[model samples]
Target: MHATTPPPSTWWSRNWKWCVPVLAALLLALFAAFVFGILMLVFGAMKSSEPYRHAMKQAQTDPAVTAALGAPIQAGWLVQGNFSSNGPDGEANLSIPLDGPKADGTLFVVAKKHAGEWRYETLAVNVDGGERIVLEDDAAMPLP
Candidate 1:
């Protein structure tokens, strides 16, 4: 008599319904994680000193600031500050010292993030021996 052996069952043949859904869920979770990681990287880069430096550069070119300070921006003028974000909106506060020959003051920079880039909302300067100079938006500047 000849011996008959049963064929091994395939994975899909055994548990196709449950396995398909489980695999799809796992793939979806992985995709979400990948997207989240990318977002975190972007946000982290934005939080760096790059934006602060840009603000400082813009302040250097501002006519109002130059007229009030009456001095060219020097290297010794430090740029320092912090950044915070909530969803699509974000804020940065930069304390830029005016270490120039004619004046000494602090440029307070308030920036907001729109469309993935920071834009100056307000540039307020407090001169040590003069009045405050404020360059702001048409409406009231929002607090960070």
Candidate 2:
């Protein structure tokens, strides 16, 4: 007598009646993750800087701005995220915030090492109709 293979058992099985709830759960998890990812990407790094924290709070509740980033931004502006060589050959970063619709939001960045110096290729990002946040003068204070 020939032996018959029982059947395939997996998420994509044809007889997946028992998998509706499971599939639904998995899909829900995936959707949640997608949403969280989008939120993080849109908000940029949620690092713990006192200024940044304050900015975020302001951004959320500050009446004027629906939300605020740790700092403001400039168009075609480039500055080091930290105090470094200041030679434009180190690390650079910028933060921008949007109140609504993620599709129209984007962050700008430019990092490069040139002549033993760091240079920013691009800095500052913006929304369709919004003002760029201004980075405090002491935002990039050198570390003693």
Candidate 3:
């Protein structure tokens, strides 16, 4: 009588232990990357908006802000706010962090867009351990 040959083991039965964890790790990494991409997109949009640009400009140029925070002021990355627009009308309420050679601060802006023009309701900077400096449209000192 001839001896019977054993059936070959399936690929799944041989590789599943390693494959499962590897696949799970890959999926986790992909999901994390997707979330990070979304956050960057949102932050980039806000940073590029007109209100953000205007507020930053005002903060950087104001004499009081410079005196408190020093020159070469820079905006921080993690800005918190709500911004919405439809055609010629929109609203923006933003809290932006700032840093410079002398100190750190937060810039707050409340604005609305009408007739395609942004009108700021409130624009101010609160220097760390110092007083708040309100920026007015007519109050910006001419840059030297």
Candidate 4:
């Protein structure tokens, strides 16, 4: 009745092949999740910036913008485009409610990137009466 310890059971019996793929998959999934989270944060920041918002606030007070869209009673902003590179041009869609006289519509704002900051380049507003007002930064020209 000598039971010989069952031949010491080889290392493969520990299921390392399955474990390796499982661990690799887990690591890959974690890497993907981390990359995704980082991208979301970056895009979120680029989509809207405090500087842009403050600029919009200031623009609302401008007589030109108010003259085109009437006194801005309320407003909302939406930043568009992928800002993955330095000096990437961005656009923001502005929805503003006017005081009166002019029917409210969308305002398309084009902004530029300089020294890692955003600056207003052009602003355009199209109203219901086929009227459009465009404000541009004549001092600065967009690079071709």
Clashes of each: 0, 12, 0, 0
Compared with the true structure, what per-residue lDDT tens digits does model 4 show for residues 1-144? 877656676787788979899999999999999998987786567546643454455546666667766764344433444333345544443333333345565455556555655666556555657777665544355677
lDDT of each: 0.70, 0.44, 0.93, 0.57
TM-score of each model, in listed order:
0.48, 0.27, 0.89, 0.41
lDDT of 2 by residue, 69-129 (tens): 3224221222224322335344435453333433233344434555664344443334455
Stretches > 4 Å off in candidate 3: 1-5, 139-144
Cα lDDT tens digits, model 1, 46-108, are 435545666556557777777766658653423566677666678887776776666777877
lDDT of 3 by residue, 1-144 (tens): 999998999999999999999999999999999999999999998999999999999999999999999998999989999998899999999999999899999999999999888888999999999789999876334567
Q: For model 4, what is the C-alpha lDDT against the true structure?
A: 0.57
| Candidate structures ordered by lDDT, highest first | 3, 1, 4, 2
Name the better of 1 and 3 by TM-score. 3
The alpha-carbon RMSD values of the candidates against the true structure, listed in the order shown, are 12.9, 10.8, 3.5, 8.9
**What TM-score does prediction 3 earn?**
0.89
Clashes of 1: 0
- Residue 100 displacement (Å), model 3: 1.1
Q: Find the candidate with the highest TM-score and give its number.
A: 3
